[model samples]
Target chain A: MAAVKLLNCFVSPFGNRVRIALAKKGVEYEETAENMVTKGPLLLSSNPVHAKVPVLLVDGKAVCESLVILEFIDEAFAGTGAQLLPADAYARANARFWAAYVDAKMPECAGKIWKVPKGAPAVEEGKKEMVGVFKTLEGELGEKPYFGGEALGYADVALVTFTPWFLTYERLAGFSIAEECPKLTAWAARCVGENECVAKSLPDAEAVYQFVGGMRKHFGLE
Target chain B: MAAVKLLNCFVSPFGNRVRIALAKKGVEYEETAENMVTKGPLLLSSNPVHAKVPVLLVDGKAVCESLVILEFIDEAFAGTGAQLLPADAYARANARFWAAYVDAKMPECAGKIWKVPKGAPAVEEGKKEMVGVFKTLEGELGEKPYFGGEALGYADVALVTFTPWFLTYERLAGFSIAEECPKLTAWAARCVGENECVAKSLPDAEAVYQFVGGMRKHFGLE
Candidate 1:
């Protein structure tokens, strides 16, 4: 068997998706931590366009983008572990829909809170936007145990990866994902707590907050 | 075999993608063209969130999003036509990377031209932004015959889908994709002229320009 290797760092929601997927699939792989700050050569060469981490290097080949990696893993390891998606077409498409939604809309919304600069106009705007997204997510969650309504499918994987970040943002930004979105928040907590892969994969919430807090400075926020 | 049905509108580049894929694959299917100006139950039910067209209803199950539809079709058909993606993992990732880039980045560039108001401020700003993106694309294209190089691949499909709109913009907006981006414009022409599927999939260029001219009234550009 060609040895599997993952180029990632600690607590990357994007990377965590792959990490948890690997663990769930029972695929043993070596994890190489790449510093996201400087974004060393290997990371650059692997993903020239995005230059981001959580790159899955199978043998020597690298795959970029979290969602793409998720799909690749599911297809490549079809028989390995719990299927990441449904065998039915509509179910799979629905999962992909939510996954795309999480990647495109929700993450950007949640990202605003993390990027809020003290006293900046964007801060207030970001807060407003975050709440709006949270409400939408809450409405979507409604009373479902998971996004797919029973199984921890791709939608759950996408949403779960962000929960750690959301927890950190709720505290560091002095806002509340749970206060405004109790069901969604509760669901997130439940998902994380129930899954050993998730619980063990995430770092302490404060560490994530501080890590992102430094990122704000690097991006020249405020 | 599950019956294939497509819900689309004439002008959406997204819809065109599915059309081209179907034509290339020699897969015959029933198509329902929706008038996007007026809402339809089929469109509404198929894609409630975006309520957009290019929804591929495979055996009555809706698969929204052009790229996702393409993937579904590729997987569903399996053995027919030119493969939309490469078989090798890294190569497939690169193709998907470019596809995502076109969907994400190219649109803002194309939108600058397509959505440009007739007035000077909007036109100038649009031209500047459009040219900026063109420059990036041109540099990326370098000396390649297509975005994915010699053989037409996913990136080519992406660029070709939107070329009709660019052609219209060049004529109506008093700008030229060719002048700003010789390589990209040449590539676009090559794609449309070279591939019978691409050519057949697009409405006449002048017809699209006339259509754009009509849209001015709706957008208040008139």
Candidate 2:
């Protein structure tokens, strides 16, 4: 077996995605938490392009980009552990599509909630857009136990990482995600309850709230 | 075999990525050329989320996003036609990484060149940045016949689609891609020359120049 090492940052939803995937796959690997503010040589050398975290090192070969790393893990560990992607081609495409959606929409919406002043217009507009994004995701989820129907799969791994931030978002933005998108909120809870990997890997809600609060204060938004 | 249909716009480099992949795979497919200005029901219905072009409809299922659609074609036709992705997992990841680099960097850089006035400071900065992007890609290419070394693989399919636009970009931006990155230019020419799929799929350079010129005029930048 090739030795696996994950270089990550503790609070990043992106890094947490890799952790959730690795845990779900039952892969035992060493992890190095990096100081993202003052990035180390390993993080810089591993991902020179983006210089972001959740880089998976397999036999000293680095895979950057969380989504790309997820796909790589699925491919590299085919037939072992749980399958992150579906076997059918169309289903796989659908999963990839929604994962891409989560990647594109989440940061912008989440940033507005945390990075802007409490009463800023950007926050107001972003809250509305974030609700719409959740509604669309709810529709995609439909009545499935998971985005992968019965299994916690690619899209699940992509999204469930964000659930911990919902508390921080709601408190900061002064909106209730549970009220607006009940189905998605329930789905998120189900993901946490159903998978120990997800539960163990997600950061504590209060801690995340404090972290975001500190960030907001540091940026002079609070 | 399932009936394949491609919803595309003639001049979009994204749509061209799909065209190159389908052609490389030798997949017989119906093509629907859409007027992007007034999108049709087919494109809208197939891809409600993005409503963008290069939606590959296979047996009535739509796959949106060019890179995702490329992977779909490779997996769906695993043993037939040309292999779009490298067989080795690491190699495939590397190809995907650079293909993603092109996708990420191309639009912003290319937009700067053609969208702004020729002598604007933004254009000058953009030209320097574009040169850097190509230089990094040139480093990735090294001496490989293709980005995939000996084969026209995923990265090649993603990138060669842009070769036709080099002419339009050069003419509008008033810079020489050949001078900045000679090897990548040579590789682009080699891609068009060596592959029937690439040759047949790409639009004529002069036609692209005319289309871009028309777009610039319409946008009042001409």
Identify the candidate with maximal lDDT.
Answer: 2
| lDDT digits (tens) for residues B144-207 of candidate 1 | 8877677677767866777777766676457777877888878888887788878889877777
- In CAPRI terms, where does candidate 1 land? acceptable
Best TM-score among the predictions, by candidate number: 2
Candidate 1 reaches a DockQ of 0.44
Sorted into a CAPRI-style docking class, model 2 comes out as: medium
Q: For model 1, which pairs clash?
A: none
Error of 1 at A211 (Å): 1.9
Candidate 1 lDDT for residue A63? 85
Q: After aligning candidate 2 to the native by TM-score, how far in Å is the CA of A163 from where it should be?
A: 1.5
